[model samples]
Target: MGLWRVFYAGWQMECCGTPFSVGDDVSWQLLLVPGEEPASRLTGPAGHVAGATDGIRVVQEAGLTVALSEDPEPRSAGAGPADPGPVRRSGLLSVETHGGAWPEVTGRVRSLHIVVQDLARGADGTWEPVPGTRTLRETDRCPKWFRGREFGTDTGRRRRDEQGVLVGLEVPS
Candidate 1:
C-alpha cells in the first residue's frame, strides 16, 4: 500500500484518507473545530482559506464550525512525466539488399513465440528453420508493406545488409 499526506497551500491538513489534488476552477469547503487557543489563518486572494494553524482541527466530526474554502488551479498533463510502462528488451534484425535483388529474409522469434515454431539445428549448431515461417521476396520492397516484420536480438542493434536494406535476422547471443 502507498501512503501519502494531505496538504492545503503547503500547510499540512489532517485527513483520515489520501487527498487528491483538485482541478482548476473547482472550489472545496471544509470545516474545522476550534480549540482552546485562537487559530492562525492565512486567506488567499479570493478570500479562500490557504493555510491555518494554532489549536484548530479540521472538522472530522460534527458540531465544530471552522470554515475553509479553496479554488484549486487547473493541472495540465505537461506538469509531469508520463508513466512509460515496463521497458522491453527486444531487437530487430534485417538483411542487406543487393542490386535489384531482394535477399531472402526471415524473422526472429522472441521468448514464448519461439515455442510455436518448429525448431531445427543448422551446421552452425544453432537452432534454425522455424516452422510456419514466411520469406520476403524482392518484389516486396515497400516501406509500408514491412511494418509488422519481426526480429529478435540480445542487443538492441538493428541488422542491415551492405546496401542498407533491413534483413530482419538477429544474431543469437
Candidate 2:
C-alpha cells in the first residue's frame, strides 16, 4: 500500500500528465495549474516540482520531492543499504560493494502527479479527509509530471525568497 492509501481515508491519485508534460526536458519548463490561481509549476530532472499549492487561504508554496534513487548511498558509518525511498542519493558516482550495479538507474524520473485533497486531523491525531475537501479532487488537480533519461541529481531549481532573495537547491527525491 502507498503512504497516501494508508493515510487517506478516501482519496485518489489521478494521472492526466503524459510524457510530454514534464518529461520533455527540451520543452517543459513551467506550467500553470488549471484553476483560478493558475499555480505555476517548475519541474526539473530531480524528483520534485516547486509551485504554489495553497489555494485562496494560505499563500504557502512548497516542493514535494519524491524518492527516485535506485541504489541508495552507503552510509558514512557504512551501516547498510536503505530502501529506495526518499534517499535523495543519485548521481554519476557510487560506492556500492557491487560497484556500478545499478546501470539502469539513470536516476531519471518517469512521471508524477499531485495528490490534491485536504487532510483533517482528529483528536486522535489521525488524518482523514474533510467532507468539503473531497470536492477539491479532480482528474487534473495538479499537473502530472514525467521525466527524461536525466540524472535526478544533475538538475536543481533557482528559488527567490519573500524578500526577493534568490537561492539554489538540489532537486532531491
Across 1-173, the per-residue lDDT of candidate 2 in tens digits comes to 11111011111112322222222221112211222121223223332223312111111113322222232234456564333233222121111121112111112222323234334455676644444432222222123231112112222222211111000112223
TM-score of each: 0.12, 0.18
**Alpha carbon lDDT of each predicted model:** 0.23, 0.23
Candidate 2, residue 152: lDDT: 25
For model 2, the stretches where C-alpha displacement exceeds 4 angstroms are 1-21, 24-105, 124-173
lDDT (Cα, tens digit) per residue for candidate 1, span 7-124 = 1211122222122221212122233122311132322222211243422222111111123221123237666422222211111111111112211212231111101222344567
Which number leads on TM-score?
Answer: 2
Q: How many angstroms is residue 169 displaced in model 2 relative to the true structure, after the best TM-score fit?
A: 21
Q: Which TM-score value belongs to model 2?
A: 0.18
